[model samples]
Target: MDETVQKSCWGVTAKAVIGLAGVILLAWLVIGSESAAMIAQR
Candidate 1:
């Protein structure tokens, strides 16, 4: 039972890490595009 609980916790932690990484990647892409537009306008 203890091992099962540990496995579940690890799964949750892994999912959280992946989700956070995806968010950061999306933000970077958005910011990059915005900056690119500004540069082009200038």
Candidate 2:
């Protein structure tokens, strides 16, 4: 029982980490594009 619970917890943590990473990557891309546009305008 304890081992199963530990595994479940790890699974949830891994999913959360992956989701957060995806969000960060998306935000970085958007911000990077805006920055590049601004630089190009100048």
Candidate 3:
């Protein structure tokens, strides 16, 4: 029982980490594109 609970907890943590990483990656891509556009305009 305890092992099952631990496993679920780890699964949740892993999911949260993956979600946060995805958000950061998306934000980085958006910012990079915006900067690239600005540079092109200049």
Residue 9 displacement in candidate 1 (angstroms): 0.3
**What lDDT tens digits, residue by residue, belong to model 3 across residues 1-42?**
999999999999999999999999999999999999999999
lDDT of 2 at 31: 100
User: For candidate 2, lDDT tens digit of each residue in 1-42?
Assistant: 999999999999999999999999999999999999999999
lDDT of 1 by residue, 1-42 (tens): 999999999999999999999999999999999999999999
Worst 10 residues of 1 by lDDT: 1-10
Model 1 TM-score is: 0.95
Candidate 3 at residue 7, lDDT?
Answer: 100
Evaluated at residue 17, the lDDT of candidate 1 is 100
TM-scores, in order shown? 0.95, 0.93, 0.97
lDDT of 1 at 11: 100
| 24 Cα displacement, candidate 1 (Å) | 0.5
Error of 3 at 14 (Å): 0.3
Model 2 bad stretches (over 4 Å)? none
